[model samples]
Target: MRATTIHAPFDMRVEEVPEPVVQFPTDAVVRVLRSCICGSDLWAYRGEAARQPGQRIGHEFLGVVEETGSDVTTVQRGDLVVAPFMWSDGVCDYCRDGLTTSCEHGGFWGTVGSDGGQGEAVRVPFADGTLVQLPREAASDDRLLSALLTLSDVLGTGHHAALGAGVRPGATVAVVGDGAVGLCAVLAAKRLGAERIIALGRHQVRTDIARRFGATDVVAARGDEAVAAVRELTRGQGAHAVVEAVGTEQSMRTAIGVTRDGGAVGFVGVPHGSGTGVDLGVMFDRNIALRGGVAPVRSYIPELLPDVLDGTIDPSPVFDMTVDLNGVPDGYKAMDERVALKVLVTNG
Candidate 1:
């Protein structure tokens, strides 16, 4: 089998590797059908995430189950499944409370948990707890692919951001960054009944896509001016909810500054550097509440899957490029350079 491996910063290659096998009673092996590059993957690709040489790169994917261990009951061979970025033991206390990301037995897929999905096949730990069974026929629905693939990460994270931000009917929400997560935040906010969704972006194409995803207003501003633009759009009152999707100090500040006093701020960007350290003083004075972390993607998948299957949301538009496994190096490069919103890689 061939997989994408990172030897060092800015160094990525495709090489032959041993195939994975079920190692635990709850584990299952999946034959990769589709996978995509995530924003967080860039940190490892850039050598900032403490990954070793030849580490596998990728976390989000949809695939068919090839085999399952004795204890795996929710899924079986031939099932098309999507899983959270993290694998969790469903019996953990946190998993019971819908905070599976914090499950005591939970671990991340690419960073600290299971083998990543950016190859021919992967071994999924806690298969019954982590994987969501999608309608077997959805693989070919382009409109639903966007939303279904999101059940694995971005769309769920975006929805988590909106929930943390307390978006409600008739409320106005502001989203910082125009990436897939941010655009999906706009979509989530709208789906949650927000009357106005303001998306901040610099690229015309991204802004256009944001609109299609439910952004009622687009601000092409940068720096503090972007904050001012969001504020001005709200007649100096600022939006009721603000979601920070860019894992940077600047975007975090933009999210905080453009929100109204007592507003809610949800942050989902994997903190890149010292990007989002909070200012206690401002938060205290403004009476704002901050919430959000890695999304409990597994917890949300059950409710979100029906929406994807029923055509209520089409999240797959985020995947701007698709390539065979051989083109994964270019996929990473394209995502890192902002030439593509998301890159989908197919093993079969």
Candidate 2:
């Protein structure tokens, strides 16, 4: 089997690696059909996020179950499933409360002994809890593949951001950044019934998708200008809710600044610079609420899967470029250079 490994910044390679096999009774061996590069993956590729040398990378994937452990009765062998970026046991207290990302027995992919998603196959622990089965019809529909893939991470993360920001029907919402997550946030806001969505982005290609995703306005400005643009769109009052999808100090400040006094900001971007430290006095004076973290993707997958299957929303456009397993490095380069909104790596 071949898998992607990051040796250092700007160095991603697909080399022959050991195939995954179930070591625990709760595990399931899945043959990955599709995987992709995430925006957060760039943090390590750019040297901003700490990553171990030769660490296996990638987390977004959907596949067919090749084998199942004895304990995995909920999902059987040959089931088509989407594995959330993080694995979790479904019975924990946190999982019961819909916060599976904080589950007591949960873990992320690519950790020391775990298999990453960017490979021919993965041994998914807690398979019954972590893998969501899809209708068998999904396997032959190429158009649905990308949308189904987004449910593993990006779409769910965007939904988390919108939910964190308290976006509601008839409310005005602003999304910071135009990355895949940001564009999906626009879709999430719309699905939640937001009356108006303002997207802050400069790229024409992404902004176009943002509009297709339901962004009512696109602010191509930056810094203070961007803030003013969002405010102007909101009739000088700022948005009722803001989704900060880019993890940067400047984007955070913009999200906070463009939100009304009593509004909330849901930040889902993988923070990249100096942490997400904000001035206490500023937040105190404005009474603004801040919420969001690694999204509980498992919790949201069930909620969003139906929509994807029913064609209520199509997020497949996010994957502007597609590559084979061996083309993983070029996929990373396209994303890092902003030449592609998102890249999908297919093994079929």
Candidate 3:
């Protein structure tokens, strides 16, 4: 089988790799039908995130079960399913509290000794607890399959950010960043019944998707200018709730700046570089609440699945480019260069 591997910064290659096979009672083997590139993947592509030579990449996938371990009961061979980016045991104390990302036994894919999602197949651990069952017929339903794929990561992450920020009916919301996750945050805020959504981004293509996803205002600026734009849009009071989808010091500051005095900020961006961009005194003075971390998408799947299946929300537009297993290297380039909002990798 062939999978994507990173050799160095700006170097991604699809090469033949050993195929995956179940090795534990909790394991399942899945033949991947769809997987996509994540913005976080760019960290490794740029060498910002270290990797061993030939390390596998990607964390989102929807597939069909080819085989399951003896202990796996929730799904079996021939079931169509979606695997969350992180595999968890489902019955842990933290998992029980809806914080599966902190599950003691869980781990992320594409890490050392784990199979990558951007491949022909994957060896899924904790199979019954990690893979969510989808209708077998979904294999032939491209539209639904694409939308369902987002449940593995971006959509769920956005939902987590919205929930963290305490999004509620009739509230004013602002989202920092126009990445796929940011656009989905607008969608999630709408799903949570926000009356107004302000999206901060400079790219028209992505902001257009933000609007389609539910953004009522677009601020195509950055830094203080963006903070001013959002404040102006919110009648100089700032948003009642804000989702910080871009993981950067400035974006974090912008999120905090544009949040109302008593509002909350839900941050989901993968933090890198120095400082968290937080000031304790500033937060104390405003009584602002800050929450959110690596989204526990495995826990969010069930809550968001029903809406995706029913078409109440659609996040597929985030995938503006599609590539096959062979075109993955180029896919990264497209995203890193800002030519595509997101890339979808497919295998028929």
Winner by TM-score: 3
As for lDDT, the candidate ahead, 2 or 3, is 3
What is the Cα root-mean-square deviation between model 2 and the actual structure? 1.1
- Candidate 2, which ten residues in sequence have the lowest lDDT sum? 272-281
Per residue, candidate 3 scores C-alpha lDDT tens digits across 251-333 of: 99999999999999999998876988887778899988999999999988888999998899999999999999999999999
Output the lDDT of residue 30, model 3: 95
Candidate 2: tens digits of C-alpha lDDT, residues 1-348: 889988899999888888888889999999999999999888878988777887888899999999998899889888999999999999999999999999999998887677888889999999989999999889888879889999999999999999999999999999998999999999999999999999999999999999999999999987789988888877788988899999888889899989998999999988876756465677899998999988999999988999999999999999999999999999999999999999999996
Ranked candidates (TM-score, high to low)? 3, 2, 1
Better of 1 and 2 by lDDT: 2
lDDT of 2 at 265: 93
- In Å, residue 227's CA in model 1 sits off its true spot by 1.7
lDDT of each: 0.85, 0.91, 0.93
- lDDT order of candidates, best first? 3, 2, 1
In order of appearance, the predictions have TM-scores of 0.96, 0.98, 0.99
**Model 3 CA deviation exceeding 4 Å by range:** none
Q: Over the stretch 243-300, how does candidate 1's per-residue lDDT look in tens digits?
A: 9998787888888888899998899987776546577788899998888989998898
Where model 1 places Cα greater than 4 Å from the true spot, the runs are 275-277
Candidate 1 vs. truth: CA RMSD? 1.5
